[model samples]
Target chain A: MSELTVELAGVRFGYGAAPILDGVDLTLGAGEFSVLAGANGSGKSTLLKLLVGLLRPNAGTVRVLGGSPTDPDIRRHVGYAPQGLRMATSLPVSVTEVVAAGLAPSKGMLRRLDRKDWTRVTEAIEAVGLGDLSAECLFELSGGQQQRAILARALVGHPRLLLLDEPTTGIDQRLRPALVRELRHRADDGATVIAVSHDPDEFHEVCERILVLVDGRLQRITHEEFHHQFHEHGAPG
Target chain B: MSRLFIDFAIQAYLAGAAVGIAAPLIGCFLVQRRLSLIGDATGHLAFAGVAIGVAVGVAPIWGALLTALVGAVALEWLRAKGRLAGDVSLALIFYLGLALGLVVLSAHGGLTASSTGVLFGSIFTITWLDVWTIALLCALVVGAVALFYKELVAVALDEETARASGLPVDSLNVLLVVLTALLVAAGMRVVGLLLVAALLVIPVAAGARLAHSFRSAMLWAIAAGLTSTLAGLVVALLQGTIAPGGTIVLAAATVFAVAAVVGRRAARRHPRSSAA
Candidate 1:
C-alpha cells in the first residue's frame, strides 16, 4: 500500500475568471481521518472533486493511489458521496440498487455480476443498518436514512479512500454524531477518509487532523488547535 | 354503424395505441429527470431521416432509426462536454435536423404527396406491416427497460450516487438516450414528427398528477396514452378530413388537462394527499 493515498501538489483550479483553489497542496496517508473545514465558496467542494477524479487541477498534479485522478482503476479505490441527493427523486429505484452502484467501477463496462458482487452489496446494506429497508423505495426514507443509504453506497465498494462531501449536512443533529462515529470506524479499518464540512465542532473528536480553507487557501491544524481557534472566535453559547 | 368505417377505426386505434403505450413508459422517466425535450428532439431527427431515405431510395424506417441513433450520440457528447444544458442542446439539435430535412425536401423538388403523408400520418393507410413493426418495437423497448430497470432507476434518480456505487452511470445514460431515439423512430409513422413529442410527454404529465409511487405513475401514464390514442383514432375517423397526428395530440392534451384539474381539486379537498 502507498504511504500517501492521495496527493495534490500545489493544485490550482478555477471556473472562468474566478479561482476556486489557488496553489493548494494536500496529502492523505493510509488510514488517516482528515476533515476539510471551510465556509461557503471556500473551495472545499472543489477540492473534494479533485480528490475523486471528477475534476482535474488546472495546474500541478493530483495523484490518487499512485494514478491519475480520472483513471477508473484509481477511482475504484475511492468512494465518494456528493452533497445533494435530489438528483434522482422521481425514479422508482430501491435502496439495494443504489448501494450496488458502488460496485460499478470494479465491474467494468459490460461485465455481468456474479455471486461475489451480490455478497458485497448485501454486506454494504447490513453495515448501514438498512438491511430491513433494502427493498424500500429511497424517497420514502427519512433524511437521515437517505444519508445512511448514501453512506452504504460509498462503503460497499470497500475503497481504500473515502471522499465524502458534507455527508451529514441535512441529517438530524442526533444522527450526526453516530454518522461521524461510523466514518471514524471506517477510517480505523485502514481506509483513508477525507470529509468536507463547515461544522468543525461536530467533527472535532473524530477527525485526527483538520485542513482549513479560507478564500481558497489551505491551512493544516491539529484538532486541539482547531478547537482553540473556534473557542477564541466565540462559538455558539 | 357502417362495418367498413368501424374496421378502419379499430385498426387505426390498435396502431396508435401500441405506440402510445410504449411512449409514456419511457416518458415517465424522461419527464421526471427533465429530459422530456430529448424525446421531442429525437422525434424530429427521425423525421429528417425519413425524408432523406425517401430522397435516396432507401427504406424510411431504417433511415429514421439510423438518424435517431446518431442524434442520440450527438446529444450525449454535447452533455459530456458540459458546453450547454440538456434542454438547450436538444433544441439546437432538433432545429438543425428540421432545417436539414427542409433542405432535403427542396432538393428533391418541393412538396411531394409522400412528404404530406409523412407529415400528417395517414393512419387510414397503415398496413399489416406497420402493425407488426410497431408491435415488435414495443416489445423490444419494454423488454430492454425491464431487464435494466434497476440500473436505469439508479441513474435517473441520482447519477452521482449511482456512479459512486459502481453503476455505469454514463453507459446507462447513453442507453436511455439511444432507447428514446429507437422509440421515436418506431412511433414517427403513427404520429408525425410535429406531434410525436406529445405522445411521449402528455400521458406521463397527466399520470404524474395522479400517481403516488413510481410504478403507479408509469401504469397511469400507459393507461392514459392508450386511451388518448384510441379516442383520437375515433375522432379522426369520424371527421374524415383531419390529420391523425393533430387529433391524437389534442386527445392527449385533453386527458392531461382533465387529470390536472382533477388532481388539483383532490389536493384542495385533502391537503395531505400526494397528487402531482
Candidate 2:
C-alpha cells in the first residue's frame, strides 16, 4: 500500500445539534491528487476542516501525516486554502503580502523575514503567473487573479499536502482551465492534493481519484464512476 | 490672548490630541472588520467602570480602564465560540455592564455626580493626572501596533488564512481587543462614553475611502483624527459653552461626509482604480 497521507476512521462530527458528518472513513496516499465531490451541506467543508485540525471529530480518529489532526508538526507540513476568499479581497492587502502570509506558520512572532523568505514568495507569485501584479492591491485584482494569488499562498511553502476547499467558486470561466492546469502542475511535482468541488467537469482531467460525500456519508469512486454519476444528474445552473 | 485662555486652549489641545491620535489608530482595523459598534460597547463599559469607581471614592480612570479591558476580552471570547453574532454579543455585554454599574451606583445612595463626567467628558476640567494616563496608554497602543504590524495585518485581512500560514491568529486577535479597550478607556475621559465611538470609527471610515493601502489608510485616519480634534477643540473654546465631545464628534462626522463625496467622485472619474 502507498504511504498514507491522511487516514480517517469512523469520524463523526456535528455543529450544535445537527449531525453533519457521521462515520466517515477515508484515506489518501502520498503523491495522489484526489477530488472531493459533494452537494451543498454534505459535510465537505466540515470534513476538510477536520482533516486540517480546524475542527475536532466527536468520535473516531483523524490522522494527517501520521499524527492527530491537532498536531502542530503535522499542520506545519500541510497548507489549506479556505473557501472564504472574500475576506482577503475586501482588505487593502497587496498580492505579494497575501502570499507571504503563507510563510507565517513557520516563523516566530518576532521573527523577521530574510532574503530566503522573499525568494520563496517571489517564486510562488511567479508560479501562479501573478508576478506582474505582485505589487497590486488584492481588492484591485479580478476574481480569477485573486484566486490565483490565494493558490500561490497555498503553494509557497512547498507543503507536503495541499487542501483546497471550493477553490473555483467565484473564478471566471475562461481562467478556470489555466488555474486547474497550474494546480495539476504542482501535484505533478509530488505534492499530495485534495480539493473539494461541486462541479465534476472542473476537476475531471486533473484528479486521479474521486471521493463523493452524500448526506455526510463518504463513498470512494473511480474517475469513470464520478463522471457517470455527475453527468447523469446534470449540472446545477 | 489672556494667560488663562492660552492655558485652557493648550490643555484642551493636549487632551484632545491624545484621544484623537489613539482612536483612529485602533479604528482602522475596527472599521475594516465591521466591528465599529464594538467601540461603542467598550465605551459604555468604561462608563460602568467610572460609576463603580465614583461610588467607592477611588480614581474613576482606574475603574474605567479595568472594566473596559475585561469587557473587550469577553467580547472576543464570545465571538470565538461561534455562538453569538458580533454585534449582538457586544450589545448584550454592554447592557449587562451598564446594569451592574447602575446597581452599584444606586446601592451607594443616589447617583454620584462624578458619573456625569464619564457620561459627558469635561475638557475644561483637564487635569495633569489625566494627561499623563492618556499619554502612557497612547504610547503602549502605538508601540504594540508598530511591533506587530505585519502579523496583525495578516490576521485582520484573513484570519483563517493567517492561521493556516502559521500566524498566531488567536493571540493576535486577543491583543487587538486589549489595545482597543485601552484606546476606548483613554478616550472616555476626553470624548465621553456616548461620543467615543465616533472617534474610533468616523475617521477610519473616511480614510478607508481615500487610502489605497492598509498603511496609508491608518496614516490618513490618524491625520484626520488629530486634525478634527484640534479643530473641534478650537471651535468649542470659541463658543465657551459647548461640550468638547460633541464638537469633536461633529467635526469627525463632517470629515466623513466630505470624504464620502470626494471618494465617490474619484471612483466615478477613475473607473478602473479599485480604490477600496
Candidate with the greatest DockQ versus the true structure = 2
Clashing pairs for model 1 are A88-B157, A101-B165, A101-B166, A102-B165, A102-B166, A103-B165, A104-B166
lDDT of 1 by residue, B77-163 (tens): 777678648466667877888888878877877457766666656677777787777778777778777777656765666666556
Query: TM-scores of the first chain across all predictions?
Result: 0.90, 0.90
Q: Tens-digit lDDT track for model 1 on A1-237? A: 448888888899999788889889887888899888877778888898887766778898999787886666677788988875656564445678678766766666545557999998988888767787777666667767777788888888788899988888767776678778888888888899988877777788887888988667788998777768766784312
| Cand. 2 TM to true fold | 0.87
lDDT of 2: 0.79
Local accuracy of candidate 2 as per-residue lDDT tens digits, B90-198 = 6786787778778887887637555666777777687877788888898888888887876877777777766655566778878988998898878877888778888
Top candidate when judged by TM-score against the true structure: 2
Q: Which runs in model 1 stand beyond 4 Å of their true positions?
A: A1-4, A16-19, A86-159, A214-217, A233-237, B1-14, B83-96, B106-110, B161-170, B212-216, B234-242, B261-276
TM-score of chain A of 1: 0.90
Question: How far off is residue B55 in model 1, in Å?
Answer: 1.8
Best by lDDT: 2
